[model samples]
Target: MLVFFIAHFVLHWGWLVLNTKKCFRRNKEIKADEIIEAKHTAID
Candidate 1:
């Protein structure tokens, strides 16, 4: 029973960490795209 509980906790934490990393990466990409767009608009 204790082992099952530990396994469940670890799985949940791993999922949360992976999701957070994915979200952070996506946000960074979006910001980078916005910056590029701004630079292009400025040049034009």
Candidate 2:
């Protein structure tokens, strides 16, 4: 029973880390798009 609980906790934490990484990557792409758009607007 103790082993099962430990395995479950480890798996849960690993999943959280993976999710946070994906979220951070998505935010970076969005920020990049915003910068590109601003540059285009400034030139026009």
Candidate 3:
């Protein structure tokens, strides 16, 4: 459960961190592909 929470929220947090600047400048436009790509990078 703890690991699940960390994995879920870590990906969410990473996505948020990656898009924070754009979110602040424009709007909450989350590019999920980028998040997925990041996950792939980590997995690799």
In angstroms, the error of model 1 at 44 is: 1.6
Instruction: Specify the poorest-scoring 10-residue window by lDDT in model 3.
Output: 24-33
TM-scores for every predicted model: 0.87, 0.90, 0.44
Candidate 1 lDDT by residue in tens digits, 1-44: 99999999999999999999999999999999999999999999
Model 3 residue runs over 4 Å out of place are 24-44
Q: Give lDDT per model, in order.
A: 1.00, 1.00, 0.80
Please provide, for model 2 over 1-44, each residue's C-alpha lDDT reduced to its tens digit, 9 standing for 90 to 100.
Answer: 99999999999999999999999999999999999999999999
Model 3 Cα lDDT, one tens digit per residue, 1-44: 99999999999999998798767655433456667789999999
lDDT score, candidate 2, position 37 = 100
Q: Which scores better on TM-score, 1 or 2?
A: 2
> What TM-score, to 2 decimals, does candidate 3 have?
0.44
Ranking by TM-score: 2, 1, 3
Clash counts per candidate, in order, are 0, 0, 0
